[model samples]
Target: MSSPFIVVPTYHELENLPRFTEQLWTALPQARLLLVDDASGDGTPDWVKSHLLYQKQLFLLERAGKQGLGSAYVAGFSWVTAHLPTMEPCTAVVQMDADLSHNPDAIKDLLGALDAGADLVLATRYRGGVRVTNWPLRRLLLSLGAAQYVKLITGMPFSDPTGGFKAFRPEKLGELDLEQIHSDGYAFQIEVTHMAWRLGWNISEVPITFEDRAAGVSKMSTRIVREAVWRVPWMALHRRRLKPRTESAFAQKRSSS
Candidate 1:
């Protein structure tokens, strides 16, 4: 039977994939995991292929090159919608990193929030006094500062607007023009949330203890930071001009709730 789908974007995450997937299944046994690999030259795709033989719910989408995180997730989302099509009881689509930074156990809290009427759930690190571990103070400050900048420019009140750990009800997410999301970095996370906000989706946050990656280098770079710095203000300015589909009345739901 089809179930809530998870889209995990990966690049050279071979060290964490096996452990993450195992814990993910234990956390949500009914969920299907869609691993989107951007040509991780580290044998990640091969390992996934072998595991698929036994783990029927585990699927892989191998890309030709190392695309950005945004593109990989967009591909995974499109794949899930096209192939799995969110049947009967399964309504949510989860997106997280392949590295163990995003705790697999927190999947329950996110899914639980969705079950309790949240149209979208953000697994936030700043909800309860900066729940991040192993990150230097400088890096933590940058993240916190960026979130504030996002709030000021785009008016998104999410504590972790740039966080990669999030879930959305498939029907709510389908309202977005997914193909038009071209941001190829951390900005992609913000753009998706902004789109959902513009359409008035009821977004909620669940505090999660985000940890440093157990293995693999982080994808963060100057380009990603630069994109977010400029794109946020640009999005806020052109949001109405884009002329998205009719919005749901839940637009103010996040703030009110």
Candidate 2:
């Protein structure tokens, strides 16, 4: 199997970047990382450019301003897809946070699930039980409630639908019309996974221990939460428009055979 590419979106994350990259590289030395910075004035881009290791293993995408997390990820994935043929090919495109909230050590479990034939692997904090660490009670409750709300609104059965830690097959990631994903914040997570599920992709979940970020402040805002609140049901109402990509590919294969 080829190495995976990790996409991390950052804004004012300088305090956490060094340690995060150290642990990430230690865990998956072969993997390459793409850090999409929304012009974080905290010397983030400068740090990336100056780091010796980053010269080969890490790539930076500097945006003009604070674009939302969803758009940053879309841009990163699109970069990977466009360059994979010319650059070193990767087996998967993994998306995670830069604040050390998503553990790098658990990345192997996600990749292992992909090797086992899952088209998309979600690093879940609620599969068997809640596995979050160092989070306040109210925040934990909010996250749990959001998961339940997503399932109730969208009829998607996956636990932790809003979790950002996930791995995607390169081809499947490439097939997505990134322009159609207009959501930001939690809604973006739900929308992408919902699209894959609707397309009959083989989705699976792996339990992971999610931790609160060790450094820097969170980027969450009331606006983001409000967006998710109204977007969930909208996605459900439009589910009929999604055609199963897997079934279409299978049909083509059968016809050829």
Candidate 3:
């Protein structure tokens, strides 16, 4: 039996949960949705319980304070791996946004990539037909620049290295050295993926339309970007990613930005 689960981290996103539930139920009927919430003061937990659609197919985890995206995911993954052990077989553990930047339609693409034997599948906006809607030019450039820089430095073939929406093979859970991961923001994604690549896990990217959130203020800040800047190379040093990819057009972009 194949079991796939999605981990959605939320904070004051009461308005969008219904749509997320609806779309996931439509797109991947076989999967379960886990909402990792950071004690959203906007009655988020109560709302999740009240909704008929959300009540059945979804489960919620409440944290004491507002944990960043990476920490929420790590906690969710820890719970998922422990409760739903893959000792019996392969399961897909997928992560995406609660606000719908990662389209429901893209779930199939990520799953299909996993089916084709990839250890992980990334929903990449920078890969081909993927598009970014409503994002300012500066934001777009910065994001793409970060992903490209990671690739150039680490020689990663993935187009959207910083993308949040992704699927992981359950068996790969054993490979996760959680102690090595020290990211709470963008670095969270960067560190894990880089480690996966270093471990020689097969990864693939599915084109996706990256949309800015419809109802929430942008959580991303200059601190996140600056953190990525320092942490990435620091990771490179520790992980020995010094080998440059063709002189790094990505690095040039990062420096210019």
Candidate 4:
């Protein structure tokens, strides 16, 4: 019985993978996990195979060289869709950080929001007085500022539009014009939401506390941020000129109740 897939992209996260795998199953015991690791030279694939907890539940795809986060996710997404073509009760696809910044427990809330009818559920860090640990004030400001800029330029409703943790109903996402996603950096999140918005699908957010990675270096680079900032506005101005494979209507749910 194939179930929903949670696509996690990894670089040299061998040390973090085992913990993440354990946390994932605890929160989503039934969901399949697709971990796509770029050639991390850290023996990530081998490490995965050695983990007993994974058994038949975890799957890994290794690429020859380092690829951007966007490419890793795209590959993982394709693999899940192909392998679980007839997954009986239907499936949802999730993209999230492997660094533990996006808590695994929060996945339940995101899924709950989707079950309540959101086409896409973003695990937002800005909602309520949600806590984020170990982040310097400077980093927090820049991240929030970036999200605000994306929202103003793209007209997306969610405050955490730049957040990496999100889920999409597979059928709705499969029907998406996947090729329309051009930016493969931090903007990847924005591009997808923009696509969903253009398709007129229901999108909403759930609050999640984000923590800094307990180990390993952050992949966030200035270049990636610059790429996102430039690309988001450009797409906004040209959105009408582009055509997409049609699917759902972009409407918000009337009430949370």
Candidates in order, TM-scores: namely 0.90, 0.93, 0.87, 0.89
User: Which stretches of model 2 miss by more than 4 angstroms?
Assistant: 244-257
lDDT by residue (150-246, candidate 2, tens digit) is 9998788999999999999776775566668888989999999998888788999999999999899999888888999998998888864676434
* lDDT of predicted model 4: 0.78
User: Model 4 over residues 174-214: C-alpha lDDT tens digits?
Assistant: 55666656567678888888877877889998888899999
RMSD of each: 5.3, 3.5, 9.5, 5.3
By summed lDDT, the worst window of 10 consecutive residues in model 4 runs over: 248-257
The lDDT of each candidate is 0.83, 0.87, 0.78, 0.78
The parts of candidate 4 lying over 4 Å away from their true place are: 53-55, 86-90, 241-257
Q: Model 1, range 1-257, lDDT digits (tens) per residue? A: 54678899889999998899898888878888888898989998889888854347888888999888998988998777666432334557899988888998898899889999998999999986889999989889889998999999988889999899998886566567878788966689999988888878899999999999868888889899999999899889888444454432233233454
Which prediction has the highest TM-score against the true structure? 2
Model 1 regions lying over 4 Å from their true place: 52-55, 86-89, 241-257
- Model 1 has a clash total of 1
What is the TM-score (0 to 1) of candidate 4? 0.89
Checking candidate 4 for backbone clashes, the offending pairs are 200-249, 200-250, 201-250
Report the poorest 10 consecutive residues by lDDT, candidate 3.
242-251
lDDT of 1: 0.83
